[model samples]
Target: MSIDANKELVRRLVEAINRDDAAAFEALVAPEFLLRDAVVPTPRGPAGFREAAAVFHAAFPDFEETAEDVIAEGDKVVLRWTARGTHRGEFLGVAPTGRVIGFSGMAVFRVADGKFVESWQCHDRQGMLRQLERAAACEGGGGR
Candidate 1:
């Protein structure tokens, strides 16, 4: 795929995430795909992305993802993004605190055969944890 096509694939991925559409992931991501640096270990391929999306959506149902930057070269595309939402469910063992929160992250994807073959992502887990802790403390629960 051309560089523009590769970048478009990444954009579609962001759209799928915003919609929380697992089927879209399944169609766009290769069966042998791998995602790294996520909150949890994802199984290979689109199933892993589906699982990862479910976890975050379960915790923040109203979350919206935005691609702040997208750049592509050859078969690689980089996307910087932010997700903002109100926490209404458990997250990594943290109970729901109805807290409004946001997290920023970046991901790099490698495309082959017009499908995402692999990707590495990095996000602000520590910042999110601290926010969750603050929410707990404010909601009459002592933070760990």
Candidate 2:
């Protein structure tokens, strides 16, 4: 596929995330695809990716993902995006604090045969933690 086509595929992936469409997500990913997130501390394959997405969806039912920009070269597509959602479930061992949070991240994807075969993502972990801390404060939970 061309660079434009790869970029479009990445865009659709982000859209699927915004909609929390697991089927769409699965369709775009290779069966053995690997996803590595800086905040997660480990690499996750297709099944693991699904589990992670499920946990995020359950935590933030109204999650929205916006792809700020995308750059494609060869079979690699790099995506910059921001995700906004309200915390309503456990996240990173933290209990629900009912706060809205927005975090930005950049992900590099390797596509093969029109499907994402691998991805490496780096997100604003400290920023997310700060937002959660602020939310906890609003809920009368002590400072972190």
lDDT of 1: 0.90
**Which portions of model 1 miss their true places by more than 4 Å?**
141-144
Q: What C-alpha root-mean-square deviation, in Å, does candidate 1 show against the real structure?
A: 1.8
lDDT score at residue 38, model 1, on the 0-100 scale: 51
What clash pairs does model 2 have? Answer: none
Give the TM-score (vs. native) of candidate 2: 0.90
- Residue 2 displacement in candidate 2 (angstroms): 0.7
- Clashes per candidate (backbone, < 3 Å): 0, 0
lDDT of each: 0.90, 0.82
Worst 10 residues of 2 by lDDT: 38-47
Count clashing pairs, candidate 1: 0
Off by over 4 Å in 2: 41-45, 141-144
Tens digits of per-residue lDDT for model 2, 1-144: 999999999998888777767788778888878888755543355556666566678888888889999999999999999998899998887678878899999999999998899999888988998888778776784654
Q: What TM-score, computed on C-alpha atoms, does each candidate reach? A: 0.94, 0.90
- For model 1, residues 26-117, the per-residue Cα lDDT tens digits are 88999999989657778998988888888888999998899999999888999999999899999989999999999999999999999999
